[model samples]
Target: MTLTGHSLIAGEAVAGTEGRAFGINPSTNEQLEPAYGLVSTEQLRAATAAAADAFKPFSSLEPVRHARFLETIADNIEAIGDELIERASAETGLGAERLRGERARTTGQLRLFADVVRRGDFRGVRIDPALPDRTPLPRADIRLRQIPLGPVAVFGASNFPLAFSVAGGDTASAFAAGCPVIVKAHNAHPGTSELVGQAISRAVRDLELHPGVFSLVYGAGTSIGQELVADPAIKAVGFTGSRAGGTALMRTAAARPEPIPVYAEMSSINPVYVLPGAVRGDADALARQYVASVTGSSGQLCTSPGLLFVPAGEDGDRLADAVARALTGQAGQTMLTEGIASAWQQGFRSVESAAEVELLARGQAGTTANAPAPAIFSSNLDVFTGNRVLHEEIFGAASLIVRYKNVEDLAEATDLLEGQLTASVQATEEDYASAAALIPVLERKVGRIIINGWPTGVEVGHAMVHGGPYPATSAPSTTSVGTLAIHRFLRPVSYQNFPQELLPAPLQDANPWQVNRLVDGEAEIQPR
Candidate 1:
């Protein structure tokens, strides 16, 4: 359980000859001990080579074994206990309770994927029998099933270090798809990353699987990330970070000789629309909840509401006053790192200085070193349409209120919005007609639309989607959460007229895996 400041390359702790960096405590502005080593380009190459070597054996695992492997990884992560939580909290300025919840979420998703593997439904098996007695021509036998896309490269995020770090959803989904993974640890929480990486390595060692199934690498800067995506061994990528970082990786992936899919989750300002009826009734309660969502976790979540639309009338003025009153005197929370805190300050200031944007309320700053006071700004719908600055994401406890004339203005404003992860509507039964009219417009602009709720916490389940179009995510058809995420690392292949002895188990007539399939265009349902 001891911490070793070295990159783990395929179950081996490889010390880097490159430069080193230390994790800094943002709350105290102090450096943590045992600086983590950064790997050289050659070491990174070896890691990717190891992953490529493991692809065949790793991808060919049977149903029971593959399901158990994922479950064992979840057990190993939970076994780490308080050491993991304490280290994560110290590295990032998050609370112990929050880290515990994230740990449960990480393990829970792994177990969920284990169930998915056991069901054997992710293979997507289909078969078409030969019609030999046809009048003119005979149809040949054909079968199809999904296969793993070799090794995957996953980049961790700055926020939610546990749920989005090593062995998080990206890694879990890739493993569930029977693909090897190489994770580039987030520098903000190196110790946490190493601890979780060791847990995964231990699972591989105990299960007698290929050592190259997983690797955790560290590098000084963009060199390591660029080389990883360009490597032929890597087939796909899963990333979660800023828009700039995500787009940079996309460019690198596109420029390669053999292009790969990069599923990067970038910026999202998840907007909230307050209907006139709901704003007219119990505006104070709605204001309290709105303020809570805006300031939660210092507004560091990807789904935090950054923009809110309110009607411009006497009722709207009363709601706006309630919002300002609710946000006032609130204390700010500590941010993850010094760089993040600094960037947040710069972002809020840039938007605040824009024309037609005025500060409506300001909360007290925390006592911590990097914590800044939370604030809210107000503007008009016309200004929001013309001013591009108001549309940008400020990654902190800052939001903007845009007052619109009526439902028509609300719809028009929504049309100008960028693609987002989520959009919420605070409406009542009386406002159902207006809310229904905007559903189609919101559907085009966001991945998930919620009624009478805020967009702070994301649910992890079978139907959850943590993806969107363009800047929200690189791939619109996939999600980084839920069991559906496994499809990202899978590609379907059809076999024609293959010998019975040569066919794969799932596609064979005997149904060795006992999975349901579409036979002659009809689904053969199986018991779970």
Candidate 2:
């Protein structure tokens, strides 16, 4: 499984004439080989055209074979083994242990989607029988089931190269929904993208699926990416990147003749609120955990707690001091790319220069090229609420702390904030009264609420939500993680007065797919 600089298009290794770019090792600032070839307009169109050609067969694949296809992708990715991990580590500065876990997540996501396909619940079946003799006007027989969108264009994220890249959640969900996919490999890790792209290609070959079911292309700049979204063949998009980047894609999709939906996870300043009783419970330990979450992955994670609220009193002072000490002992690690490190520095300086903010603590710098020192700042509720710059995400190992005089001030501060992926609350039983009052406010502003915990690690499961309103993600009704993400690529179709022989398998009277259905407003249970 050697790395090639070519793009994988419809099961073919297509060399790009557009341009070439190399993945750089952020830890050492060294160029990695071989230089990846960027796709031309012609090549990009070829991939999408292939995808459109594949949608008919790929979307209609039988349940058993479709599930096996996903499983085979996981097996092929595991077969790549150490070479995959080593290449990903070099391309991105993430540690080996972390990449190993991410690799498992990537494979686990594919396997999870495989299970979803086998169950066939994603088809979302419903039926209403004809009422022939009940009334003057007979009701017509109707059935409904979800169908796949034609094709999807997925943009990789810079932070999680494995779990958010080529064979990540977006691709897995789209495949589970039975849509073909075209992935635009993130520029920061082309070599890593190539490896995973090859694994998916192998899976397509092994299962004898349509060749265009999956395609991975490289882009030298924004032109190729924007063109992908504007292409008529692509019906929807899955994107995880900067807010600006996500919005740009959104605009392109909207400007198209046939506007499409762009499911983009842009930015978040996941906030943490520390109730008075909880601050009194274990200030020292809470401060340490807070700093740990801030500095994890050099604070590049989207869910990192960017803002923290503490009670204003003697107990709060003790907690603030603990936070300072904890931050001072911490150190930053190598970031994913030089560009990301540069942006983090710029954002940190802007927040540090604000007159209302006071520097609480600054940590030691890492012993690498792109790694920078971590820092924390402090202010009051008035300053945080009044200053718009203070409310923005710094996108690095920097955080801001604001003290509130009472529960009313805390609730007001929470109300003023923008949409977030998560909001964490540290509270004891004694503080539940105050914490309970703020729950509705948090429900309006964030997607997930955490009690007595941090917001760094995201669990991949059926009920987990990795999305939110507005700035957190473009689509408030959808999630970019877990099993529910499959709905992003599905659209419901209703059949009325149709013959039983013409009905799709899932909507058929006999339930040939063995999927559960809602029949005449009643549950029609089926064996798993």
Candidate 3:
């Protein structure tokens, strides 16, 4: 498959008027062929307008067709094969095995949403029969169901290029909710984004759906993305990146004449609390696991355990020593980009310069431009509690061990944390009684709480939540992963005293879709 480097707008390949940008391989620092042109503001408007035109027919489609459309997208993505993996691997510096798994996750999420559509629960249908014979005024019949919020603007992420990029979760969920999507391709992997974007376009064509159902735009800077968010046709936005980028989009959306929701997954230093029992039981094992989690994908994961809180004592000291020993055996790994690598180095230097922070260990040096050496640092409770810099996420291959003197110190540290995507407690059965007190605090601070586990791996399922409070995400009530993510692009509408023929199939008297629904506040599954 040859790369065109053109933006896909309304099913047509359109060239950008702005300057061009090339995809560079992070490992070798080599530029890939075919410079991608930046989409102009006019192109952005055209894409959004196309999406607005596509919304009604696309959203009003039968649930079965929606499921088939999502399934077709998964098939098209799979058909792209090894070329997809190679381009993504070169652009993002992620290994072939990792990209392959991420590709599977990307397609799996699409199929999962397809299943979600087939089940029809996303509609959230409810009905209330007319009570003409009862009450003083005779109650009128009412029906309710969730409807799509129109076109959505999605920003692709740099780290997980396949699973969070052009045709990833945001696009899948938006389509599942019956909204048209316009994706802003991440600059780091424009080729990869183009490939996936084309795959989705092929799916749209195969299904004979609206050509405006999906569009992909590339940009050399933020202008195109900002324009998309500010466009009147775009009803919502989905973003995943740095705090600065996410918050900027939030501000842009808020400043719009008609403000919209921005579901942005921003920075998170997922904290791991090491209970007394776990630290004392096997410090070596804990150290090994912690090191592996921190260094995974060069610590690019949003749920990476960047902070570890351990009870201060001989046990904590032993654990720190074990971690230092483990770190010495690990090698420096390639990051997603040169910018990220530079930022990691600067963050490591900042930690080293801190007065009370002690450098534990450093990984073997790398031979490339974008590789990052892993480092571990430790600080006492007093220094950690007083320094706000200690709380910021480093974004790569480093973690801070904060020694807490007692449970009170741990509570205080937890209180100092901002909202996070995940928070974990490594405890044994014996530590349950003590760990119970911290559960409520963890619940308030993070989207997901893990017990005796790491937070790096996010499962895509019905119950998973990849969102949290401010700084973690703009909206805490919604998730950016799993089947529930579809809800973010949906809003409910109630039809009162409507004719049976005018009602949507799901809310009709016959329940034509045969979906489980609430009737007069009671669960009902029977047709009519």
Candidate 4:
């Protein structure tokens, strides 16, 4: 079967002018279809211009009307959620069940943004009353509101076709905030991206939005991404990919005359600390859970637990054996792309070269179409602390188990961990109490700290932060999940001496919206 999904520009599917990239199915190692060629400089300019122009009218729409548009998009996405997931699985080689769950999360995120708009939380409006005094001159009132950044460019990730692709969270948040989007589809799943892009197109028409509000382009090289971010019309960018790729685009954005904000959620190790008490009590269950987390989606998730810290003793040995057996029992599947598979192999070789690390069990290699079975390694904390490569993300179904001799050993390992999206602590109540001394140290190293849980399943809700310092993400203050993500699309604007008629609704004395906010120094739900 073959399918060619062309580039979408100005609400229309357009072919590339200069070059073409073939789409390779990771599941079969066979070419499925041809994707649109690299978007030339001219195409990038046109797309950027369309988005900039579209933003003017979209940003001017009333918040309520904007909220309705977002709801319509969510409705359209949900209506075709099944088809989206199926195609995503076929293209990217992810399992059907996992993709289905990701689809639900993706649509749920879109609706969450709708709810945020409906509640007027994103308005971020504030007002200070005018003051009249006899001894001093009268002062006019001050008002503040969120304004949309002009246009945003989004880069889809290879592992998550539906949730992080053309119509993913980055696009959904930008669209909900009244910022038009220009998406650069990942080559691994261009066909799936095209399908979802069409859904979004139908949505825009149904909601009576500008045709130029969205554009999806495809290219093999870095040129398209560079052109998009460097374009004067683009105001910001959202990216999820490797550090090398993200850093290149970030540098391009930073070099521009008017540097723009680039929110890039790069990869991470997402370490887990297994205390002695938990291992002593029930090492088997924790090992089984780790196996599932490590092999889930072939360890393609950015939050997969790559580096594990196990306490030393007879219990630690039992936990190691159980985890190794569990991973060996699970069958390995094809990765999202061949490039990823090759990289995984390269990482495996590197781990094999480490002197102190011992290979416990290695799954048999499969055909080129499938990845090798999961592998596990055992080592001491000394080796892990000495080698910086041990902390880097391997991006496959592989884990390194490090044994800690004492509290000091565990603390040393925790202190050396890089910034991560999640840090899991597997400990009994007593062990949890014992580790209280190291809790604050771990807190500063990760965005979210989990107890008796795996970090693979990221929930999309308020207070869900999928970002961390440095390698986990480029910006810690921003998050890729939840309604708070809309902040990326908004900037603050302050107004003074404005007439009552000219005042924004949120600043109006009527307090028509009745949204929760801070007034003076107190929390309230009324206009000044």
Tens digits of per-residue lDDT for model 4 on 1-528? 224457888787777876877667788878766555667788878888988889889887676777777777667767775667677777788878888788777778888887777677687877766776624677667778887898999999988887887877888889878799999988888778787777777777887888789888887537888989999999999999999998888899999999999999997888888887788867677878888899888889988999888888888889888887776667777888888988998888899898988987666555547576778888888888999888878898998998888876676677788888888888888886667877788778788888889999888888888888877888888888777788998999888888878876667767666655545445565442
Candidate 2 lDDT over residue span 227-256, tens digit each: 999999999999998999999999999999
Off-target runs (Cα >4 Å) in candidate 3 are: 526-528
Q: TM-score winner between 2 and 4, please give it.
A: 2
Give the Å shift of residue 455 in candidate 1. 1.0
Tell me the spans in candidate 2 whose CA falls farther than 4 Å from its real position.
none
Query: lDDT values of the candidates?
Result: 0.91, 0.92, 0.90, 0.81
Clashes of each: 0, 0, 0, 1
Q: In model 2, where is the ten-residue run with the lowest total lDDT?
A: 407-416
List the RMSD of every prediction in angstroms: 1.0, 0.9, 1.4, 2.3
Model 4 TM-score (2 dp) = 0.95
Taking all chains together, each candidate's TM-score versus the true structure is 0.99, 0.99, 0.98, 0.95
The regions of model 4 sitting more than 4 angstroms off are 1-4, 134-140, 366-368, 511-516, 526-528
Residue-level lDDT for 501 in candidate 2: 93
Regarding lDDT, does 2 or 4 come out ahead?
Answer: 2
For model 1, residues 1-528, the per-residue Cα lDDT tens digits are 988999999999998778997888889988987788999989999999999999999998988898888888889999999999988988889999889999999999999999998888899998999888877999999999999999999998889898887999999999999999999999989999999999999988888899999999987438888889889999999999999999999999999989999999999999999998888899899899999999988889998899999999999999889989998879889999989899999998898889989899989999998889999999999999999889999998999999998787788888888889999998889999999999999989888899999998877899999998878999988999899999999999999999989998899999888888999999997787
